[model samples]
Target: MIPITTVKYPVNEFFQTIQGEGLYTGTPALFLRLQGCPVGCPWCDTKHTWEKSDNARVSAEAMLAKTAPSEAWAEMSAVEILNVIEAQGFTAKHIVITGGEPAMYDLMPLGQELEQHGYQLQIETSGTFPLHVTENTWVTVSPKLDMPGGYLVRPDCMQRADEVKYPVAMEKHIDALDLLLKNCPPRQDTIIALQPISQRPRATELAMQVCIERNWRLSVQMHKYLNIE
Candidate 1:
């Protein structure tokens, strides 16, 4: 494993694309997907990123060559990541640091560097680990419940989040979110969004009803709808 102090991260992939979900949906952004996660959601789309191994230690070029899901990753220092962004000529000012659980590693250094360079940073996490990003970073916590991984959402993680984007697949999912909201009253600025799982019709219907009843917002996966990554 790469040392956290070295400012090196195990990267699964990086690409410039539209923000797929949550509060920043439809916005042009650069996605930095880090590798490794143990909090397994049964419907997880990126199962390939669940483990880290020697196969993940590849060159940056080889990492970018991947056009499909693979258990491959590359270690990249913050400076090297910035170079790649510049080389790619990404014009988006927003940088989304997502992962197999981004909170599993410290993100303060990278967040600080991105802020210094005038880039806004956002982190998408599962809210199972303590957050360590800059205050300016937008933290989106999509809490996983009753998943294969037995990890519970940490209250501290919820309190630190700018938004709680919950995936709704059934009534039980909404009930879990309700219990979570009651347990952790979010900050005044915290946005609560309900995203339908896999864009299922039943899930979408449930989300819409709940959002209306609770006066929360709906976050459809626009990227998935548009057939984009």
Candidate 2:
């Protein structure tokens, strides 16, 4: 159990509309994009998030002001954060805790507070950190190979992931995915989604075949193809 006494000063970005992909697609939710990711996926869309120095260290109030005022957000204490969410007119039960790898911080307090309020927590991670999350929280692990900081694949990440979302560009990515999959438990409930590298037809086709051969699922980046951010 994470100590609630620990203060959570999330160097967070803004809240947005519905998530673009994953199990929470189409559902309206708040996006907490915490800055600082070292995992370098060649095709990472939010490359801005890659460098922590690139983002301004703004107060949560300043961040919230950019959105609807009635929509609540505050540079808050964990307890204060819950109050802000209640203040927000947001009725959506889903809350996406994403990042520059949100796992970099201990999320037990945040997850516990949100879950207490009946909000379903979902974390989008790179399968690097030993995730501090609730049992019910959905973990989407998009593994990157040979990234900066010399972070190799860790088994704890693959094993904990409820879904394995891979970004496919060339055959090499499949090799990387297979390497990671070798460590995971052979559970039928584990969802494997193959998203093509930048909507490339050839990459998509390759991914489709891989999926069909292994009975894996293809996760098209519907938002990217539609040109929605």
Candidate 3:
């Protein structure tokens, strides 16, 4: 087994951007996107991150230099990643750990290291894999149901989420979420938000209607609208 100190995360991309969704919308954040996910969501925008190609591994510098999205990834230990962040002089103290299903690997090491330096952590995950993040990490479990990967959302993950940001495109999607909510209730104060699939008009209208009726929040993929990274 790899030693804890040497534990490296296969990173797809890292950058500072405005958080475009969930309870922390509009927050200035540093996004550290990890590579690899088997929980296939058909509408996933970062399909380049779905596979960690062995031949695509490159130096951290080369990975960061990437201007276009591709399968290229770099393995960086907690310390190395921290150094890069510091070197870039990033102003965002709130770091978002996302994927390609980031929870597929243990995040505690990265979390602990980041937190030690006074950065708050948040993870966006499909509540399928077992979560192994810092206790203080804000968990956002966007339940993925009936995906091609054949993974089931974990009750523990739903219960632990600080926010449940479910993606919706139809009445059936809402129905599925209702069932999940009933079966795996989140914390009493857990924020529930609906994100329209790819800003489709029907999906957005459905999401807005449901959010209005249920007092849920709406996540409009602000980055997409703003045409920002």
Candidate 4:
């Protein structure tokens, strides 16, 4: 693990966009996508981000040229990141610290700075790493079960999440979610969301039924539907 304070994180990309999933869906947000992930889910859209070495480092200006996917990234410190965000003139008050597993790095410094500057912080993680962020940070744990990486979702991560979002592509996926939920701490306010995998008809149907049966929320990837990043 890298030292949080001194590390210049390998940033895959960063941009202002609409919150396309989970509880913050539809909200304006600045996405700070970090690099490197070992939790290799087969259905992962950002496959280019799987390996840190796959991307050559670029300037923050070059990295933000477009919101589209790219095999390019940059290294930036916490303060440098804030500078880039400021330079971009993003008005979105929400900051989504996402990944290639953003939890792959200690995020307390960056998250704390963003919160201190009045930005609402949210972390989108695979629930495979021990989460280390401020208490106010909204942790969204989208547990990846039996993925190619063979990493088990950490029970402490699920317990820490404000929302547990499950991507359902089949009945077994739902079953996995049920088993994962058993490990979560009994919190009345903990939100459970069932997101259909890639908006597939069968998956959507299954997710809708499960959400209704369990009284969970449905999280369809709105960015994919709206043709946005």
lDDT of 2 by residue, 1-229 (tens): 5566466645455454767776666778777777667777665666656555523555666766664222222344557666666677667778888867788877888888778878888898888778888889898988777776567656787777888888887899898788778765425587898888877889999999999999888888666666754
Cα RMSD of all models vs. native, in order, equals 2.1, 3.9, 1.3, 2.2
TM-scores, one per candidate? 0.96, 0.85, 0.97, 0.93
Better candidate by lDDT, 3 or 4: 3
**Roughly what TM-score does model 4 have, to 2 decimal places?**
0.93
The count of residue-pair clashes in candidate 3 stands at 0
lDDT (C-alpha, whole model) for all candidates: 0.89, 0.73, 0.93, 0.85
Over 4 Å off, model 2: 1-6, 51-55, 66-75, 184-188
How displaced is residue 182 in candidate 3, in Å? Answer: 1.2
lDDT for model 1, please. 0.89
* Prediction 3 TM-score vs. true: 0.97
Residue 39's lDDT within candidate 2 is: 75
Ranking by lDDT: 3, 1, 4, 2
Candidate 4 lDDT, tens digit per residue, 62-127?
Answer: 777856787688888877888887787989999899989988887888787777778899999998
Descending-TM-score candidate ranking: 3, 1, 4, 2
Candidate 1 lowest-lDDT run of ten:
1-10
Question: Between which residue pairs do clashes occur in model 2?
Answer: none
lDDT of 2 at 219: 81
